[model samples]
Structures are given as structure tokens and as C-alpha cells.
Target chain A: MDLRAKLALLADAAKYDASCASSGTEKRDSRAGGLGSTEGMGICHAYAPDGRCVSLLKVLLTNSCIFDCAYCINRKSSDVRRARFTVEELVRLTLAFYRRNYIEGLFLSSGIIRSSDYTMEQLIRVARTLREEHGFLGYIHLKTIPDAAPELLAEAGRWADRLSINIELPQVRSLKELAPEKDLAGIHGAMGNLSGHIAEAKEARRTPTRAAPPRFAPAGQSTQMIVGADDSDDRHILGTSDALYKKFGLKRVYYSGFSPIPDASAKLPPAPPPLLREHRLYQADWLLRFYGFETQEILAGGEGGMLDLELDPKLAWALKHRALFPLDLNRASREALLRIPGLGARNVDRILAARRYSSVRLADLARLRVPLKKVSPFILAPDHRPARGQLDSAGLRRQLLAPSAFAQAAKPRQLALDV
Target chain B: MYSVTLESPADFAGWREAARGLLGAGIPPEAVSWHSPAEPAGLFAGPPPPDVPAQSAIPPVPRDFLEMAERAARHSDPERFALLYGLLWDARRAPGLLRTPTEPRMARLEAMARAVKRDAHKMHAFLRFREIDTPEGPRSVAWFEPEHHIVEAEAGFFQRRFAALRWSILTPRRCAHWDGAEIRFAEGARRADAPADDAAEDLWRTYFASIFNPARLKPDAMRAEMPKKYWKNLPEARIIPALMQGASGRVRAMLGQEPASQPQPPGPRRRRKD
Candidate 1:
């Protein structure tokens, strides 16, 4: 097939894996030789119709697979048109796109073609050519084949900024029933090996006895778990994520809501999960990572095991535990203030600083552009008293759930939120 | 009031020197009027303010304040200089003033710095380079219109990132060029100077259209991140409207289409048997 035809097929095949992050890699630039730079913040050059950031040239090497994972779009059994890009073609595409500032770099994944090691070797070769041949100093993310040889996995790490292995299903039973070819233990084993190497490389870089530290996936490893694909609820999915994070020291755990594909298998769900569920999961994930919320705390914010679709997880937690509301803004600690509905981490820091000089008032939060209505009932400022026990009202959740307020709050940075 | 003229729009060094002179001279922020060379001089414009030496005895501001002032200098706000200097002047009197977000002058200065930083970030994100074949070799060129006086301040980012390739980024206010080794600045150039498109754009547009999941179309979300203002220069943006128009139909077709025949069990060579 022609290059355009191949790209269309491959990108379509790869779209289901929603891991487009190109950040947290070691900062490198082309000043010395190559053709890119990554300084901390990953830039989203474009946004796709799905509200996903087009940061990297997220595509697969080929849509041909040996394994028949039922939920995957590129399963070998599926009759969708398949295409593969030669290594040279892949390299050229990356450079061409990089030259045009269309992407951060290449995010190359391939369905298991030939064998696991062989597919991994091909993925590594693309990265090697970019870094070694062309001296390209851009961000690269490689989806690792779990069963690939350890030496090949190590080599893959040397050339790429981040490496990932998909734990496709949350439950072992689901994996066995739907994707029999996948091994949960094998995936975990690879993740364990990667975590060790990543930690060692970081240590080497820190206490360098030699010229420079040997790089091994400097951005670390991440994994994706498909939501709404099986019988897994939010509790089970988050539990899996929490375990992976603790055990493997992962950089991120992406939650991709199962969307309908053109040639989906009979085994998959009839409809995708509500997109808001995916959004809520991301919010919960943030709370877990940044806001110091435990897994239990976040799960408590949800009903049974599912997150509340209407309210944000943080707000849900605050509403459920109304005793925590009306925390004195001036007297509250950073941790206490962080639990406030409208307060983001940035605003909390600002409040801490602003309060050091004088007592923080409602107008002060307004200047920081805090969502006043969402926060007003939960915080007690010098001039604001939450309408004298507003938190005690039974209709408080409904009052805060006003559609106009939610719309205004959600509109500003909804597109920028990434999983 | 003293009329101080800065060397350039994003001239943090010049602003720092002038601010030091004013501060050392005990001149209040209200007593000074700041202007860059880009601004038209009034008929009654006074002579440029006297410069202060580096060793001038101004009260020491916190390191964070100095850094924030540096960023705020790149803001397009005409009052940016005054705002920063006013904050600096306030910092000397009020202990822990820089930490106070509620302080009016400090908050405004922080806001200005944040805006300038955000503008620089957007420039980093949105600048789309088109390949142009020069006599020497292939050179990548991009045309960007930034919302702030950030072209010079943000040039180092491009220089560091695209140092290997020969590239030029032309903006309305100024232009930056990198030729593998050294980065040079020149006067602003017209948009016509940069190439409009590259050969790979068609393939890129193809990838963009295919990767977009029609089942989860959120044009509002897409527009929020890749704002409409940037759509003109983006190669893939031309297809967005058509894609949006065709999304519902495409999704309906997918939902309506019969499920594909499930693939048979794993092949004989596969490690794990289904």
C-alpha cells in the first residue's frame, strides 16, 4: 500500500491505545547534533476529535498480529486492512514530522508479528536509528512486548525515553477469557525487571563516577488498562493501577475507555463507557498522585465501586463527608485546604503564600480565579460565612450541581486534561 | 515623572538596570513611566532616565521575586514594567510580600508573569515548521504570531531543541534563526517568507483523521486546547471541519455494521494456545 494508505490503517489501528504523553523525559536538545528537544513540559501540537492530545506521532509499526486479543482492533482474526512500515520508512516519517513540528517524536507499537522478540527488535531498531543514526534528540516511547528477551528489553530502554507494557484487562479471569495469549505474570515480570533497571540508571546518573550515566528509559515505564472492556468496575481497575504503581514504580497508568471500532469482535461490549467516567477516573488518578488521597479515600467518593459521573471525585468526597466542609481558609493547613472543592494544587500554594501576609478573603481567591461558587459553600473566608450552615442543607449537592456553573467550570481546560 | 525607554520589548536586563536606578534613587513606581522602543514617543516625551550601576544600593529582593520579574518583563502589557517595579518596591517595605497572592500589586505581577510564561509555552506547542529546500540543504521554516513579547525570550527553547537542523521561525514582531551552531536574531519578516506546506503534510493529515475516534467526538474539547486562532497554520486543521461533519455518520455506520468474524484460535507457532 501507499504511505498515506499505510498511515491511515496503522494510525487507525493504534488509536485505541490512548497513551500520548511525551513528558517527564530527560531534557535533551539538538544543539550538539540531532533534531529535537524535550524540556520537561510535553507540548500538545494538536488535539484530535476525541479530545486527545496529539503529542507524539502515535502509530504502530504494523497492524499485523500473531496473537488474537479480542478487544484489540488489530487482532489477527479481525478482517481489517493491515499495513506495516519498514524501519527506514518509519524513521523517515518521524524526521519529516519532527521537521514540521507536527509531533514530539515517534511512539512506535506493533502487533506481535513473527514473534515477540522479533517485533521488539524492529521497534528498538526504529528508536536506535533515530537516536544513533540521525542523532535525533526527541522523546521516544516504545510499547514493549512482555515476552521479549531481557537483553532486547534492555536495548529497547537504551534508545527510548519511556517503555510501556499493556495490562489490557484488569482481572486475570477477563484476560484468560478474552485474551488467552496474554500472561499476567509475564507482564508483571517484565514490569519488575524494568523498574529495577530504571532505578539503577537513575542512581548511576546521580552518583556518576564515569563521564555520564547509562540511560535506560529515563522517563520510566507506564501501562494502559482498558476501561469498560470487561466486568471490571472502577474499584477493581483502580486497585490494579494502585498495585502496579507500588510494585513497578510506574510513571503513569493510562485508563482508556473502550470506544467502538469499525471491525470490533463479538466478545467486546456493545457500548463504550461514559466518557465522563473516563474523565472521573483521571481526576481520581490525579488525587491519588498529587493530592495525597489514598485509594480507599477515592473509592469512598464513588457509589459502591463506580465513580459519580455528575460530580468531580474530589467534590464528591467533600460532599459525602460534609463534616470536613467549612474549613477555615486562614487557619487550615495545606493538606486541609487541598480538600476544598474549587482549590487546585496551584491555588492552594497561592493561598498559602497570600495568607502569610494577610488573612485570605473571598476576593483573594477570586483574583486567583478560583471557582467561587464551588468553593464558597465549603470554605469560610473573613467576609464569607457559607450563608450560616449552608453545608448542613440537604439540597447542597443539587445547589452545587447547577448546570451553568458546571459548564463554566469545565469549559476552560477540559481539552488540556490528559490521562 | 521619569520616562524610561527599554532597549527592546523583552529587555529584562534594561528594565532591571532602570529599575535599580529608580529604586536606588528612592523614586516611587508612580514617579516613572516605562516604554519600549516599539512604542511611539509623545511630543512632550522627556529624556531617557539615568542608568544605575550594577553596584547601586537597592534593597535586596528575594531570588523568587527576581525570577518572576524576569518573566513578567516579557508581558505585552504596557504597564508590565511598572507593575513589576511596583511589586519590587512593595516587597522592600512589606515582609514576605512576594509570598502574598492577595497583595494587589504582587498578584497582578504574578498574573503577568504567568501570562508571559503561558504565551511562551503556547509558542513552543503551536509553532508548525514547514520544510523548505534551500541551495545548501533542506531547511525547516515556521511562521508564528505570539500574543506577547516572547519571541526573543522563547528563542533559546527552539535553539536548544532544533539545534541540529537549519531552521528559521518568523514571527510578526521578530524572527529567530538557527544554523546548527549559533542562533541569530533578525527583524520581523512577512508570513510569505516561510513555506506554506511540506510534502509529508498529506500523510500527516491522513494519520490525524484516522487516529481521531469518531465515537468520542468532542469538538469543544479539541478547540479548547488547539484554539481556533492556531488552525490557519496547522496542516491537519483543514480536515477538522469535514471530519466533524462526517463523524456522526461514520460512528453510526460503525455501530450499525455487523461485528467482524472473530479470528480463530492462536496459530500453531504461537507460544500460548487459546
Candidate 2:
């Protein structure tokens, strides 16, 4: 196929991976002699109609895989159109797109063509060429093959800013049932190996080194799990994510709502994308990372191991634990202040800073643009207090669900909740 | 009241120099009126204040206040300089006024600085560089319209990122040019001066269209980040309407099609060493 057709096919095949991060990499600039630079913040050069950031040129080297995973559109049994780009074609395409400011860098992945080792070598060749031949210093994320040799994995890390190995399913039983080829132990083993190298490199940088610390995926590793594909609850999914964060020191864990695809396998029926569930999962994930919330505490706010569809994870948690209400805004610790609904970390810091000089009040919160209607009942300020029985009223949850225009239009079921 | 006219709309340095003289002269914020070139002088415009030596030492303010004031001064609001000066005056008296983010005056300044920062970030993300052949080799030119006076402030970002190439970013208010070595500021030019399109955009549009999944259409989220104001300049935005219109039908077709039976197992091609 030609370049345009190849890009179209490969990018379409790669769209399900759901990772476009280009941030958190070591800073580099082209002034010293290169073609690009990466500060801390990743810029979304464009947003696709899918509402996803197009930070990097995310495409697979080929869509021809040897394994037949059921949920995947590019399974061996599927009759989808297949295409592959030659190493030169891929390299030239990346440089062209980067020069035009169309993308931050390339995110290269490939299906098992000849073998795991061979596929990895092809990916490495593309990255090595980009770094050595062209001096391209932009962000590069490589999808490392799980079963590839440790030596090959090390080489991949040297040239990449970030590396990833997808743990496609949350539970190993489902992974075995759906994808017979993938092994959970193998995926974790690869992640463990990468984490060790990343940690070692970070430690080396801290101490004085004669030569610059050997670069090995300075941005660290991340992975994706396909939600709604298996019978895994939110508790199970979060438990797996917590383990990955603690054990592997992952930078991110993407939860992609399984969407319908053409030429689908007969084993699993197609369904509409669980967009709201995916959004709630992200909110809960944020609380786990930044808000000092434990997984069990977040899960306790939900029913049947699933997050409430109408309320955000934080509000749900706050509603469930009504005893924690009326926390003093002026004197609450940062950790306690973070648990209050509608108060983001930034605004919490502002409250902490402002309270040091003067007593914080409801008016001050309003001036900071905090949602007073949502936070007032949960917080106690000098000028504001929950009315008698207001916090204990059974209708409080219903009152707090302020159906936004977008939410009302997107979810017709929200109207049914009123009845 | 003393009237002071700044050299330009985004002249933070001039405003600072004048404010320092006024503050050292013990002039309160209400007694002095600030004006930029864009803002016409009122009927009661007074003569420029006379230079006065410091009667007493000007109290020290936090470094954060200076940084915030510098950014807020680039805002298009005519009262930005006066507001910043008022904040500075209050900060000198209260000592900790700048740290109180909830204070109304400090909050307003912070909001203006945040807007300026967002405008600069949008310019960095949305500016599309189109290539044009030059005698030197190839030069990339981009036409962007920023909401604030951030072209000069944000030029270093593009220079550091694209230092190897000769490029020019042209906005309506100001322009920045980088010639592989040094960055130069020039008078702004009309949008027609930049190239209309680049040959590489066809593949880019294709990739943008193909990467989107019809089942997960969320145009509102896309618009929230990439607003409609930027659509006209982006090459791929031309296909957005068509894509959104055709998304439902495409999804219907995918769901309506009968599931394909599993393909017969192929003969083993190669044996694994493990």
C-alpha cells in the first residue's frame, strides 16, 4: 500500500491502544542540534473526533499478528485489511510529520510478524534510526513485546523515552479464557524488569556520575487494560492498578472502554462503549493517585463493586461517609481537605495559603470559583454552616446531582432517575 | 491625578518603572491613572508625574507577585496596569497580601495571569506551520491569532523546540522569526502572508480521520480543547463535520453486521524454540 493508505490502516489498527502521553520525559531541546524538544508538559497538537489527544503519531508497524485474541480487531481470524510500513517509510513519515509540527513524536508498535524478538528488533531499528541518523530528540514511546528477550527489551529502553506492555485483561482467568496466547506472568515479568532498570537509572542520576547516567526509559513505563471486555468489577480493576503502581512504579494505567469493531469474533458480542463507566474509573484513579484515597474507601462509595454512574467517585465517597461532613475549612489538614467534594488539590492549596493570613469563609471559596452548592454542606466555614438536618436529609444525594446540560443531553437515562 | 501613557499595550517594564517612581513618590494607586497606547486619554488627563526620589524605602514584596504582575500586564484589559499597581500598593502595606489568593484584588490579578498563560499555551498547541521553499532552503511559516500579547514571551518555546529550522510565527499583533541562531521580532503581517497549505497535510488529515473511532464520538470534548476559533486554520478540521455526521451510520453498520464465524485453524507455520 501507499503511504497514505498505510498510515490510515495502521493508525486505525492502533487506535484501540488508548495512550497518547508525551509528558514526564527528561527535558531536551534542538538548540544543541536536533529536530525537536520536550518540556515537562505534553501538548495535544490536535484532538480527534473521538475526544482523544493526538500527541504522537500512534501507529503500528504492521497489523499482521500471529495470535488471535478475540477482542482485538486484528486477530488472525479477522479478515481486516492488513498493511505494514518499511523501516525507511516509517522513519521518513515520522520526520515529515514532526517537521510540520503535526505530532510530538512517534509511538511505534507492531504485531508478531516473524517472532517476538524479530518484531522488537524492527521497532528498535526505527527508534535507533530516528535518534542516531536524524538526531530527533522528541518523545518516543515504544510498545515492548512481553515475551521478547531481556537483552532486546534493554535495547528498546535505551532509545525510548517510555515503554509499555499492555495487561489487556484485569484478571488472569479472563486473559486465559479470551486470549489463549497471552500470559499474565510474562507481562508482569517484563514490567518488573523495566521497573528495575528505570529505578536504577533514576538512582544513578541522583548520585554523582562520571558519565551521564545511562538513559533507560526516563519517562518510565505504563500499561492499558480493556474494560467491559471481561467480567471484572471496579474493585478487581482498581486492585490490579494499585498493584501495578506499587510494584512497577508505572507512570499511568489507561482504562479503555471496549468499543465495537468490524469482523468481530463470534465468542464476544459487541456492545456500545461504556463511556460513563470509563470516565468514573478515571476519576477514581485520580483520587487514588493524587487525593490520598485508598482503593477500598473509593469502592465503599459504590454498590455491587461498580461506581455510581450519576455521581463522581469523590462525591459518592463523601455521600456515603456523611459523618465526615462539616469539616472545618480553616483548620482541616490538607489530607482531610482533599476528601471534601468539589475541592480540587489546587483549590485546597489555595485555601491552605489563604487561611494562614485570614479566616476562610464561604465567600472566599466562591471567589476562588469553588462550587459552593456542592461543597457547602460538606464544609464548615466561619460564615457558612449546614442547616439543621440538611446533611442528614435523605434527599441530599438527589439535591447534589445537578444535571448539567451536556450530561442531560448525552444520557437520557438521567431523566428517568428523577422519577 | 497623574496620567501616565505606556509605550505599548503590553509594556510591563514601562508600567513597572513608572509605578516604582509613583510609589517612591508616595503616590497612592487612586491618585495615578495609567494609560496604554490603545486606550485614549480621558478629558481629565493630567500631566505626566514629575520624577521624585524615594522619600522612604519601598517595602519588599514577594517574588511571586512580580512574576504574576508581569504576566497579567500582557492581558488585553485596559485596567490591567492599574489593577496590578493597586495590588502592588496593597501588598507593600499588608506584607502577606500576595500570599492570600482569596483576596479579591490578588484573585483578579491571578485570573488575568492565568488567562494570559492559557492563551500562550493555546498558541503553542494550535499554531500550524506550513512549509514554503526559500532561497536558503525551506522555511516554515505559521499564522496564529493569540488572545493576549504573548508572541514575544512565548517565542523562546518555539525557538528551543524548532531551532534547527528557519521558521516564522506571524500573529496579528506581533510576529516572531527564528533563523537557526537568533530570534527576531518584526511587525505583524496579514494572514495571507503565510502559506495556505502544505503538501504533508493530506496524510495528516488522513491520519486524523482514520484514528478516530465512530463508536466513541465526543465532539464536545474535542471542542472544549480545540475550540471552533481554531478550526479554520487547522487542515484536518475541514473533515470534522463529515466525520461527525457519518459516525452514527458507521456504528450502526458495524453493530448490524452478522458476526463472522471463526476461521479454520491454519497449519502450523513454524515451531517455537521454547
DockQ of predictions, in order shown? 0.36, 0.35
What fraction of native interface contacts is shared by candidate 2?
0.63
Pairs with backbone N, CA or C atoms under 3 Å apart (clashes), candidate 1: A77-B263, A354-B101
How is the predicted docking of candidate 1 categorized under the CAPRI scheme?
A: acceptable
The fraction of reference interface contacts (C-alpha pairs within 8 A across chains A and B) present in each candidate is: 0.65, 0.63
Badly placed stretches (over 4 Å) of model 1 are A404-419, B50-55, B257-274
Clashing pairs in 2: none
| Predicted candidate 2 versus true structure: per-residue lDDT over A77-188, tens digit per residue | 8898999999999999999989888888999998889899999999999999999999999989999999999999999999999999999989999899889999999999
Off by over 4 Å in 2: A404-419, B38-45, B54-56, B257-274
Highest DockQ scorer: 1
Query: What are the models' TM-scores?
Result: 0.94, 0.94
Task: Report interface Cα RMSD per prediction.
Answer: 11.5, 12.3
Q: Taking the tens digit of each residue's C-alpha lDDT, what string does model 1 give over A189-221?
A: 999999999999999998959678888999999
Give the CA lDDT, 0 to 100, for residue A233 in model 1.
93
Residue B50 of model 1, lDDT score:
67
**Which lDDT value does model 1 have at A104?**
90
Q: Roughly what TM-score does model 1 have, to 2 decimal places?
A: 0.94
